[model samples]
Target chain A: MKIIADKPKLLTETPMHYCPGCTHGIVHRLIAEVLEELGKADNAIGIAPVGCAVYAYRYFNCDMIEAAHGRAPAISSAVRRVVNPDNLIFCYQGDGDCASIGMAETVHACMRGENITVIFINNGIYGMTGGQMAPTTMPGVKATTCIYGRDPKKYGNPVHLSEMLATLTGPAYIERVACYDVPHVKKAKAALKKAFEIQMQKKGLSFIEVLASCPTNFHMTPIEAMDFVKTQAEPFYPLGVFKDITKEEANS
Target chain B: MAKGKVEFREAYCKGCSLCVNACPMKILQISKRTNAKGYEVAECVDMDKCIGCASCATMCPDSVITVYRD
Candidate 1:
């Protein structure tokens, strides 16, 4: 019988250690699927930051670089500029590392129009290192930092990065996709492939902010976290192409 | 007629009752039987009325459900 669900060639054979219900595995598979489809797995370089997905370097089959916490964007920029200008570089980061601590770096990267594909995983709460409040945490959602609830007065409202980053002309493409369900997941994978293509074309910065789930941090079972992502988080981070600077892409 | 097979992975289910309330077709109901983790499972008895809206799978928390249509 054919192995329908074997690990993707873009990913190592190592088993992922994410929580049983976490969507990180699914998101990783989506990126790997894109890489495999494009045959760019051999040429691609991935930058992983110091958050829950810190050890992402181990899972991705391609050449990988581990960056300092909240520094993947800068590191990716450096990688693209110094080593190989023509190479495809992608930075895989979580909300804590991207939206919170590395906010300045990401904003500057987008503003600079760096030719890098940023696969941002926004699950609201920090997953790997403990359930901490992230900048993308939805209003009224509780995290370890916000025990009572994310008081908007103190924490402020969630920042929609796909929309916020798209505001800059530097980014060539910006879109939001989630793995809450199969159809959304399929769309998410397609957007991811397109984001990678955006970088391959050397058009400019391409950002795919995926709203993921953290059941362990969300204090819900994996299933419930999936529900929360679909029902709660999606409203704040509506999916679709938020920006496409290239005329052909914009028209397409 | 297009028949969609909805597969629910009970292992990741948290039983939040959102799918139960959100399903407009009323095809799914909380089962009296519990799964390995002791959570009430979501079940669909009469899938004939399913419009293939995919709202339940979309609204599920664990990313457990995969719907295949034929």
Candidate 2:
């Protein structure tokens, strides 16, 4: 039999620390596949964030740095400037890190249009910290902090980070995708590959916000959590390309 | 009549059932057998039903499933 699908060589044999059915693993696999396919797996540097994927450095079979909480963007920017120009740099961050604590870093990185890729996972609740309410937590969603369900008046509305970042002129591409199913997973992989390609072309930042699920924290089965991401989360944070300079150029 | 075969790295399987749900052919199921981690593992009940779509592998968060086509 011929192999139709197999694990990418860029991923270490270490089992991921993410909970069962966590979409983070899928995203990690996609990044590894993209890097390997682009022939940059050997020359890539990844910045692991301070969230549930804090040990991400151990998973990707490449040089990795553990960035302080919400500081991955800052670290990535600095690394991008000093690393070999051919080296591919990317940062993996969660909603709590990217949209809440590191909001400034994320915004400035986009505003500067750093030639790097940022994979943002927006799972609504803060998974690493026991499902606390995050900046991206949808209104009325129940979390540890907002156990009674998030009140828009008290917690304010969820942050539309991708849309906000897309407004910046520095970024070359910005898109939001989900991986609750096969078709969406394929699209997310395509978007991730495009992000890496854009960075290789010396284009500005390419930010991809992926809607993920937290089965353990959400107190739901893996499949149910995925359905929640599809029926509940997707409606609030619609999936599509928020900005794409190449598309704009093609249109113009 | 099997067009494809699926193999599971049982050690890495979390038995999340994502592959079971993603299998369009409905041939995947969570087996009672537990892995070293004590989580149940997924198995293909009927290889003949597999169409080599690789949907199960694509949805498997742990990347435990590998697909091959005849």
Candidate 3:
């Protein structure tokens, strides 16, 4: 007998609070798998934000702290300074928390090259807050606040956080991936693994932006939401490594 | 023939049917019965056709599906 696939030990048995078809569970499992594979579960500390993934502290089996709204980056920065160098510290934040309210904390952390990992879930809308418009919301996408579809004239353009963060020289690794389908899911997992590996190597900040699905908020079925991520979000956001100083370091 | 089985954690299943769509062998379907959480859960309708590719399990966001191979 062989176990083909089993739940990662780092994920608590608790049922996730995400609505049906929400891809947050996939990202959580990938992170949990990486934490277990890299032997970081024992010492890893995850900073959870106050959005859709606010209950992450209860889901991830490792030491987790619930940070104030969008303050995960700041909190993780402090944790990185005080904790032992070998311990892994990562912040799991939603687009609402990381890109909107906590934009300053996020930018400063990357600008200073903080030695921490950041898992950013960009589902476009502010999921936990009744699907309001977020900084990462795509153009023409309607949410509770943007009932008439987001108009660039008034709201401005969606902020491409990963690309913006890559512009700074502080981060050692930054990649954008999505959980739309099987192949994309695998790629997202691989990117997450690389992020964790960079952290273990004492490299600078490693940020991964995962374009997740908010089916309930999007008023679409789970399958339809996944399709939207592939067809709509991928074109606007694009996927691939934005920066990898570690690779350059190896070459240099 | 390969032997494999999948167990669904009924309590955790949201019955989104992503797993059903992911099944390559078309062995999965939403059960008419509902779990304690009141959401329908996916069930293996034709166990004999299961290849145990674990595609259903992989696509499951809830991590409710577990695969075993023998």
lDDT of 3 by residue, B1-70 (tens): 5578888888899999989988888889999989988998889987777777888888899899889888
**Across residues A84-130, which tens digit of lDDT does each residue of candidate 1 receive?**
66678999999888998999999999999999999899998878768
lDDT of 3 at A150: 97
Stretches of candidate 3 exceeding 4 Å from the true structure = none
Comparing 2 with 3 on TM-score, the higher-scoring candidate is: 2
TM-score of each: 0.78, 0.99, 0.98
TM-score of 2: 0.99
Question: Taking the tens digit of each residue's C-alpha lDDT, what string does model 2 give over A181-233?
Answer: 99999999999999999999998899999999999989999999999999999
Residue A10, model 2, lDDT: 87
Per-candidate count of clashing residue pairs (backbone under 3 Å): 6, 0, 0
The numbered model that scores best in lDDT is 2
Give the C-alpha lDDT of model 2.
0.94
User: Candidate 2, residues B33-66: lDDT per residue as tens digits?
Assistant: 9998899999999988888889999999888988
Q: Spell out the clash pairs found in candidate 3.
A: none
As a TM-score, model 1 comes out at 0.78
Backbone clash pairs in model 2 (N, Cα, C under 3 Å; residues 3+ apart or in different chains), count:
0
